[model samples]
Target chain A: MRIVVQEAPFDFAAEAQGFSRGLSGMGAVVTFSGLVRDDDGRLAAMEIEHYPGMTEKAIRAIAEEAQARWSLGDLLVIHRHGLLAPGETIMMVATAARHRAEAFEAAEFLMDYLKSRAPFWKKELTADGAEWVAAKDEDEAALDRW
Target chain B: MDVLYFAWVRERIGLPKERVETSAATVRELVDELRAREARYEAAFADLSALRVAVDQDLADFDAPLAGVRELAFFPPMTGG
Candidate 1:
């Protein structure tokens, strides 16, 4: 498993290809990428803040839980922290497994956990002003299914 | 112990982190001590329901003990993905 928490923007294509080729026995690979949305077309940038010591630890625990519950070959989670424009990528999760079901399910599980459990906080800067993005109730409720 | 704030809490408190010396046994008690320090702290911690706490870099409840905690953080609910 590979986990990265960085401020530099990652090359999505290269990372995705590297993850897929690194696995030896996996038959399926699933990837999810999150991007900052500018729904109103007024977003200036997003400032992400996280606890340096705790962010990696929390994500590692979540990834290990995914590995334990699913039969998988490997997984990768890359999250970015810092100021980013609306078009930039926020994070990505890639899961590889022997079958499609395990790969897809594990990817969804990781996404759900990352959405709420991680220590990262996002503040949206728009024309009006900067405001912290509130956590959605649906995001927390999504975890109950798993 | 080092007390940290993030997001709105940090903005409202006007600082990112500070060293705190407290005899409070739990997070709730520690908050009470902080609230008594200044009006800024009281305003920042006005609503516990909208806040989240982490003790020693781990997510913890407000009633969680702080016996050996070296770091404590307060922030709003995470909006990560």
Candidate 2:
């Protein structure tokens, strides 16, 4: 299991490639990527904020929970903070397993937890002003089904 | 005590960090103490609605004691993904 919380954007291809180590048991790899959205290029960017120490702890815990929920071989989770322009990579999760079922489920679970449980917050810089994004009810309810 | 702020809570208080010395035993008490200190803290913690606290990097409640917690974090609801 691996968890990373950094301000720098991640290279998904590299992360997936690196996850492929000397293990012979793994047969499948599943991944997901989230990108910053653009509204006709009207919105400039996003200023992401997070607790310095608590962010990593929260992420690691989520990854661990995902690991338990699935028979994942190796897990890679990376989330980016700091000012990010639209089209920038926001987050990525990769799961490896001996079969597709476990890898796919675990990858989705990681994203689910990342959506609501992680300690990061985002503010969007729009033409009007800076507005802090509120926690979405849909995101919270999505977790309940899990 | 090492006090940390996260997300919009930091922006509301205009403080990202502070080191305080207090005898408050629990996170809630510390918040009460802080609210008493200044208007900014009071406003930031005014509602405590949609707020969450963490002790030593662990998700905790406002009532959880600060017995062995080295750090306390306050912030609004999370928007992680």
Per-candidate total of colliding backbone pairs = 0, 0
Tens digits of per-residue lDDT for model 1, A78-146: 999999999899999999999999999999999999989999999999889998999999999999999
Docking class of 2: medium
Across B8-57, the per-residue lDDT of candidate 2 in tens digits comes to 77877898888988889988899999999998898899987678888888
Would you estimate the TM-scores of all the predictions?
Answer: 0.98, 0.92
Model number with the top TM-score: 1
Alpha-carbon DockQ of candidate 1: 0.89
TM-score of chain A of each: 0.98, 0.93
Predicted chain B of candidate 1, TM-score versus the true chain B: 0.98
**Number of the top DockQ candidate:** 1
User: Model 1 chain A: which ten-residue window has the lowest total lDDT?
Assistant: A17-26
Runs with alpha carbons beyond 4 Å of true place in candidate 2: A20-23
Off by over 4 Å in 1: none
Worst 10-residue lDDT window for candidate 2 chain A reads A15-24
